[model samples]
Target chain A: MNHLFFQINPLEGFFFGSGKAMVVAGVAIIILIGLGLWLFRMESRLQRLNDALDQRLNDAQNQPS
Target chain B: MIQRSWKIGGLALLGYVLCMIFFVPLGPGLLEFTSTGSAGHVQDQDRKVTVYALTGFGTHWTESPDQLTVVLRHGTQLASLPLIETLDATHVLVGMDLPYTVPSKSWDVLVTHPVDGTLLLENGVFLQDRFIDEQTKWANPEIAEYPAELPFHFPYQPQILETIRNLMLHVPMWFTMFLLMGISFVASIRQLSTAHDLHQDTKAEASVQIGLLFGALGLVTGSLWARYTWGAWWVDDPQLNGALVTVLVYAGYLVLRATIQNIRLRARLSSVYNLFAFVILIILLMVLPRFSESLHPGKGGNPGFNSYDLDSSLRAVFYPAVLGWMMLGTWMYHVRLKASSIERKLRQLQ
Candidate 1:
């Protein structure tokens, strides 16, 4: 195996073999980050929308419908 | 309603779990059998065949007066077998009978060993297709195309494997964002027709909120994917650019909503402004990147690289991610409504 490396390129082995593992890990990280941010931002938006609506309604009632 | 919610949620969970159970593919796509000796390919009909009755690891052959029977088969097609004689301790001498001829084509030839009364080989010989022409003693040699690619094969078909776990999270962000923006679009439209529909305003507000959720998610997931795949937090790709533009447009929607206070004017102008933004959103995210090529999955003349992106193992988890995120989005929307109603009740009390 050592002698095979001396004759051939190191990227050749990784490009074919363990390179697959790299792609798998790389894509997984991408997906993970997307999901986490989605959850967090959605959560905050839901809260903000409710608060803003309450303030608007309060201001409306104070002026009389 | 609370009890029903629990039951419905339980049933959905059960159904999802059951779908995962049918994941195992069961069929005769693959088969294996053990035999006393290695199976040999059928060269032709006239070739003398031997059967060994095994005593141990090696078979002990006996010469019998009974005529050796041979059955030649090409898949289901049965052909006449050559007559053979049982000679010596092991070998049978087959006599070339009735002009021994067989079409050169890969066939699952079935040859039975007489001694053990067992199938010798299921796939005895694989032959190449070459019709033997009578005019030429040799097979009619057509100029065959030099076998282009040896055979289509997989060289580590590298794609999102467990990366599919990201689907649950990454893909859902877009789903949520799309859902929220869609509602906002509807609310703005409704406000135009129904002069003073506060409900529409409420919906519009809710929609932008959810859109923000999705936009943020898309960015995080995309950035994460960029880091892992491209070894950077960001890159200038068409699809990514379009997604960024869509998020920015939604952010602008929020800014526009906050700046105006006249409910009637806000509803009318915000609605008009939102309509334009969504039109731009569709053009930028849905249209432009598609005309140009994109690193994102679905773009370019290429239908996109998702053939291997989603495997069953990942699909098992991905569907749940979508459901969970969607349910969570609905939950948020519902809470917003509740808060709206509570405020209404409190005002009536006042």
Candidate 2:
């Protein structure tokens, strides 16, 4: 267990060897992913809201008023 | 026209900051030193010791070998060592004659060059005392005067090294988060004043959402920085814990908003809760950290990067990065607010 804990995987080794510049890359990637997820959630919410609005409009048109 | 300019300006400024962060080179710094015969430790009996040094970027040691000089400093006393050889641009050998009795056991190394300025390695060499003599006289050499005009470069910190570039990224995230949270706080106040205006409530909610996102990014970047610098991903630090708690508290505000069924009651309750959360944010992030012991810089009586670490070169990019990030975060909050308004309109139609 101790040996395993001390052993650095290839990915970790690459980051460590590169003067931890990859850590900065990792941070930038995380921010990009976060922003992307937020945008996607907004898109889906808008889609759902548009569908609801369309359904209401169709129901109003069908009714004899 | 004015509104469009800010967005364009923000993008431009961030692009400039990104370019500068990557392109700017670090100043000269001493990495490590070694003695040819005895390993860095000198005894009073030893007459001469030749010390070899390895330096990080911008040294240019071989260019003007005549101007380069090495000195050992113990408190106020200084002794200039002879530069024996300049091996390369980044390596040099200096010879030091051991004094019979010195003022101190620990000695600081200062390598000075006109072009590179002065690079210091604190407690670089240690002396093993054969006898402690109180009346021994020490030579005091004058410190080198740096030229008025020096090349523009980031300050090379021994520990931080290249990862210092993260300053532009990590620090700006918190600044952006703070600006968004401030917007949320103001909107919440307006929400309470204006007789359950759902628009104001939506504004508060949207800003909090964006603020939380920026706060999470700050935590992640800070954790990575801490992992490299402090040798731990997470430490029991006051400033760090305070920031984490502030993020969690804002998260609690979102959870509270979801639980309430009636729209009017929800707005009222959440607005009041937002006020409390904002207060908690200020206390946890700004006030408490200052009073307690913390590993994070600028907290717990620790002199912040502003005092010595943040040189003029760093400030050139850092201020613009903060402003750019805040503008981007505000733009995101506006987008979130617009979507929320459209959603509200659709729900009202139903």
Candidate 3:
């Protein structure tokens, strides 16, 4: 884990001094992360809905109505 | 098919914008020009003065020194100066002969290159004058024309530099947020008119959720950009404060909804609150920013990129970016609305 962290040092220097290009990269990354979180939240909601419907279906079948 | 096309189209447009943002180069700009000696000023009696200039981004001064045209501009008059030497691609030594009389003490330096177009340093040199002369003849009079058919490139802004490309990402976030908020506002109005229709309420809630996401992203990105350019993570600008407050107000709408136990009451009360929130949003974002001094472009005393800064090159990618982000936001709202409707139906069934 320590070695893995050190690998980023070279890249960090380039990004930090690259005529403020790092700022653009930062903006793009923030957007990607935000959208990715929303996607995951949507997925989890659908998952919960699926589980609830399946449970209800099981209950209805067992009742023999 | 149409539904799928829009989603795919929006993604493709954003992909195109992403490619252009990183690859498109920035044009050259004059960063600083200073007199080589004697307190960085030229006296009226001084016949010859040497000046050194430092340029930023895409400048090729040494490639063809002869192609470079240096001029001192005072008001409408342009007096051409000879380029004494090219130290490197970014540094140049220029010799200027002091005119006997001039319109004003302040002179703007214009360096026109065949490749870099025309780079200007405002008030590049100052002259020590005993008296002001309104009528003066320029020794070397030449009008510089910017080269035609230059390649597509973002205009080099001194403070912005390469980060100027953030215009594509940062600006579109707010545009997308506005679109979602507008949708939510309309849905809230419909919910109120229909006497608290649950479906309309769901639509309003979903749109606000997505709008808030975009608004949060906008603030974060704007803050990062400000940190790099303005040397601060957060400034007390009206536009920035207004955006933060608007996002918080919508967040309050969510909290208000979550607190209410009764479904009908929640819909009715939140719809009324949404109306007021949108009005506050308009006043803070559009009206107040213009009235007060703001560091953000297009507000207060600052002229926006629209007046001149946003060139054809930027407009090419920027418009597509705004459209793409709007489409993506609408798609997210659609997903949220569908999920919420399903959850509500399941609750009712139980």
Best by DockQ: 3
**Better candidate by DockQ, 1 or 2:** 2
Each candidate's fnat? 0.03, 0.05, 0.11
Q: Candidate 2, residues B1-350: lDDT per residue as tens digits?
A: 79667766776677677667756766677776666664332334354564655443546777778888788887787888776667777777766565666777778988888777788899988776435565666767777657424567788776676678889989999889889989999988998898846899999999999999999999999999888778899999878888899999999999999999998888889999999998998888878877877777775553235556677889999999999888878878887887887778777766
Candidate 1: TM-score, chain B only:
0.54
Ranking by DockQ: 3, 2, 1
DockQ of 2: 0.11
For residues B1-350, what per-residue lDDT tens digits would candidate 3 score against the true structure? Answer: 79667876887788678778866776777766666663233333345554555443457777777888888788777877666667777777766565566777888888888777788888877777425688776655766677533577788776676678789888899888888889989998899889735999999999999999999999998998898679899999888899999999999999999999999999999999999999999888888877987788886643234557787889999999999889888888888887888788688657
For each candidate, what is chain B's TM-score? 0.54, 0.92, 0.91
lDDT of 1 by residue, B1-350 (tens): 68336434633543453333222211111011122233222345434333222111111125232533433344344544443434433333333221324543433422233342322334544333245333322232122122112122111112331223344557767777777777878878887889855677777777677678778877898798666556678888887787888888878877887899776787788889888988887777667876986777766643323646555555665567566566656555655665655564456446
Query: In model 2, which regions exceed 4 Å deviation?
Result: A1-65, B38-57, B133-135, B147-150, B301-304
Candidate 1 local lDDT, A21-52, one digit each (tens): 45644554455446445544654675676577
Off by over 4 Å in 1: A1-65, B2-162, B301-308, B340-350
| Positional deviation of residue B175's Cα in model 2 after best superposition, in angstroms | 1.1
Clashing pairs in 1: A30-B225, A34-B221, A35-B169, A38-B217, B106-B127
